[model samples]
Target: MYYIAHRLFAAHDRALAAQLAHHLALKVGEHQVFLPFCDTDEEDLVADIKGRRLFELDRERLRSIRALIAILHGPSPDDGVCMEIGYAAALGAPVILLTTDFQDYSSAPAGPRTVFPDPLLDALATRIVRVPRLGAPAQQPGTSRFANFAARNHAQVQNATEACVEAALQLPLPLPTISVPIRDGSTVYAEPSSYTAPNYALPGRTTIAGVTVLGPTRFEAAEPIPAARHDWAAALSSTRIVVDGSGPETPPGAALLIGAACATGRPVAAYLPRSTYTHATGREPNHRNLMVQYGLEATLRSADEVTAWISG
Candidate 1:
C-alpha cells in the first residue's frame, strides 16, 4: 500500500485531490492517501498553540507516507509543498511531482517558452509527470460549453492520476547520483589547447554514468550562488566524461564544461532517451548540432549505449 501526499488548498484542488485519491486507490488496490484540507477546515487565523499542534499532526502524517506527490500549478510551487518536499527527502521517501508549469523560467530560456515544470522540482522528483493545463477555456465559438469543459477536465485529471499511480509504483529505488555544471548565464570562452587527445577514463579507471546540471542552483530561492558554482566545478572536475542530459537547452554551466572538456581534450557525450528527448525538447534531438557545437564525441540513445561507450 502506498501513502500519497498532496495539497488541497483551493476548491478545484480539493476536487482534483479527491479524484486522484480515488484513481490511485483503484490502481494500487488498497492504498492510503493524505489530502491536506480534506478533514480540516481552512481558517484565516488560528491560535499559536493550536497551530503548533496542527503542524505536529501534519508532520506525523508526512512521516507515515511511503510516497509524496506534490501538485504544482504555476511558475513557483506553494511554500507548503516545498516544505513537504524537503521533509519527505529528509526522511528518504521518493517524491513524485505533478505540474502543469513546464516552461524554462531561467534568465536565458533554453528552448520554446512553453509551460515547463519548475527546474528545482524536476531535479528532486523521483518522477515528474507533466500534464496539460486543466480547464483551459476553449477560444472559438461553439467550442466552449459546460459539457466540453467537464469532459476535458475529467480526462486531464484521469490521465494525470494514472501517471501519478505509475510513478508511485516505481518508488523505493535509489535516486541517481550525477554531476554536471550549473548554468549561471555567464559568458564562457572556449580555449585552444594542445591536449586534443580524448581522455574517457580517470586515473583509477572510473567512467561517468551520467551528467546532470544542478537545476536548483539557477534559482536564487533554491541555493546560494557561491555554493552552486562550487558544486558545478566539483562535478566537472570529478568526472572523466561529462554527459549532456540537458538536451538542447544546455545550461551555461554545462556549456562551459563542454568547452572546458574540448580544451582539455576530454570526451563529452550526449544522452537522450527518446522519452526524455520528447518531454524536454518537445521534438527529436538535433544530434548533428549537439556534436558540432558541443564537441560531443557521440550522442547516446539509451542506458545500454552509454554503458557500451563507458566500457569501450
Candidate 2:
C-alpha cells in the first residue's frame, strides 16, 4: 500500500517535508508500497507511477496491498482527502491516518474507522496479511569512505555561528581570538569591544599575529553582525585554515567553508552554540542526536564538556 501527505506550507518547510517524504517513499518502496504524492501534477504523477514500477515498487505487479498510511502532524482540515480515504475504505483497502494532534473526525466521516497510536502498523496487522520476517538478515554493504568522512565531520559542519566556535575550541590547536575590520572602522572577531582603542586589546588580552584577528567577517546587510567568523586556520593544515565565527549562529556560507576544509582531509571544527553543545554528554540525547545519527562523533567528542559535567 502507498500513502502520500499533502504538503501545504511555507517554501523551506515544504521543501524539507518533500525530502522527508522521499525518505518515507524509499522505506515504503522496500515493502512494495506504491505511494505517489497527490500534490504532483498529472505529468509528474504518471511519471512517478511508471518510475516506481520499473525501478522499485511495482503497484500493478503486486497482487495485493495492505493499506495507505497518511501521516498528519497537525489538525488542519484535509477536506480534499475525506472523499479519497472514504473511497479506499469502500473498496476494502485500509485507510490509516497518523496524527500527533488530537482531532475528532467522526462527524466528518472520512474513512475506515481511524486507528490510534500507529495507524500504519494497526492497518497492516489487522486489515492485511503481514509480510513475514526473513530468517536470515541480508548482508548490508560496508559504509562508503565519503559517507564515513561526512559522518565524522557533520557536528563540526554546523550551519550556525555558535557551533563554529565550539568546533574550533575542540581542535588540537589553540583557537585565535577573531577580529573583523569594518568599512568605517574595525571590529574584533565581530565583537564590538575588540575594536576599542588605546591598546586595541581587551583587558587581560593581547593580540598575537595568526593567533588573533582571525577574520574578514562579513554580515548580511540587515543582520547585526557576521553570522560566523573564520580565521586562516592553515597552521594546523599547512595552508590557510578558515576559522568560523563563534559569536553568532553559522550562516550558509560558513557551512560550505567547513565542508571544504573537511573534504581536504584537514581538521575542521565548528563553534557549536553553547545551547546546542551543553548536553553533548548528557545521559539523555540532546541536540547531538542528528550529529550522532550522521556519524559525527569525532567532531563532537570533545573532553571539555564531558570533563565539566563529570566535575559538576
Candidate 3:
C-alpha cells in the first residue's frame, strides 16, 4: 500500500485528491492505499487539539505505507504537506513528488525574485514527475463538481497515479536529467530588441545534475547590454545538443536566442501552449512554418510526450 499526501484546503483540491486516490487504488489493487483526506472523517477541531488522536493516527499510517506520493502546486505547498513529506522521508519510505508547476531552483536571477521547490523536498524525492494541468479552466453550467473535476484531470491524474504505483511496485522508471533555458517574456512587446535570459525551470523525473546559466546573466545584476549579448552567445555554446524547450514566440530576444540555437545545428523543441503559439505565429501550428521559422524539431503538447522524446 502507498500513502498519498496532498493539500485538501480547497474543495477542488480535495475533489481532485479523491479521484487520484481512487484511480491509484484501482491500478494497484490488493495492496491497500491510504489517502489522508479520504481516510480521515473527523473534523479538525482546534479546541480538542490536545487529544492528539488525529496526529497519532496519521503518523501510524505514514509509518506503515510503503511509499509516499505528494502533490505540489501553486507558488508553494501547504505547511502541513511539507511536514508530512519530511516525516515520511525520515521514516525512510521512498518519496514521489509530482507537480505541473515548473519553477527554476538552480539559476541565479536577472530580474525579480521567484519561488522554487523546497530544497529539503527536492533532496528527499526519489522520483519527480511533471504532467500537464488536469483539465480546462472554465466550468460548464450543468456539470457536477466531481464530473467537472474528473473531466479536467482524468488523463493527467491517471498517468501520474500509474507512475506512482510503478514506483511503489519497485518497477524501473527512467529519470532523465535535462537542461532548460531561461528567458524573460515580460518585455517581449515593450522592447522587442532587448534580450535577457532570466531563469529556467527544468522539469523531468530526476534532479538536474547541474545547470550552467550560459552567460553573465546570473540571478544578480545584469551586465551592460553588449556584455549581455556576448553572454547569450556564450550560453548557447554550453547548451545541450537537444534543447527541450525553445520557441520563437518567447520574448523577441529569447526567440532570437532559440533561433541561434537552431542555427547551431542543434535540435530545439518546444511544448507550445495554445496561447503562446497563437501569439507567436498569429495562426495555428503548421509543421512547415514551425521548422522554417522556429527551427524546432518537434512541437510537443504534453509532458508525457516530452518525457518519451527525452528518454528516446
How many clashing pairs per prediction, in order?
Answer: 8, 31, 5
lDDT score for candidate 1 against the true structure: 0.49
lDDT score at residue 256, model 3, on the 0-100 scale: 32
Report the Cα lDDT for candidate 3.
Answer: 0.48
Cα RMSDs, all models? 17.8, 25.2, 20.0
Worst 10 residues of 1 by lDDT: 186-195
Model 1 residue pairs with clashes:
101-116, 102-115, 102-116, 102-117, 103-115, 103-116, 183-252, 183-253
Q: Candidate 1: lDDT of 248?
A: 30
lDDT of 3 at 95: 74
Highest-scoring model, TM-score: 1
- Tens-digit lDDT track for model 3 on 1-312? 577777755776777667667777777763577877456543433323322444455667876666778787754454345546645554456678777664644334444332323233454567776664665643678878888777666666667666655665663344233233343221111011112231233322232333322223322333233343444435344433223233332332323334344434344454443323211212333332222233455655655554444444
- Model 2 spans > 4 angstroms off: 7-20, 26-65, 73-75, 102-312
lDDT per residue for candidate 1 within 1-312, as digits (tens), equals 244444444678777777777777776654366655553333432444433444455656766667778776764344345546645543556778776553445434442232223333444556778876665554556765876787767767777888877777777555443333443232121211111221222223222333322222333333334433443344344333444343334333333344345434456554544322211122224332221233556666665675566545
User: Weakest 10 consecutive residues, lDDT, candidate 2?
Assistant: 185-194
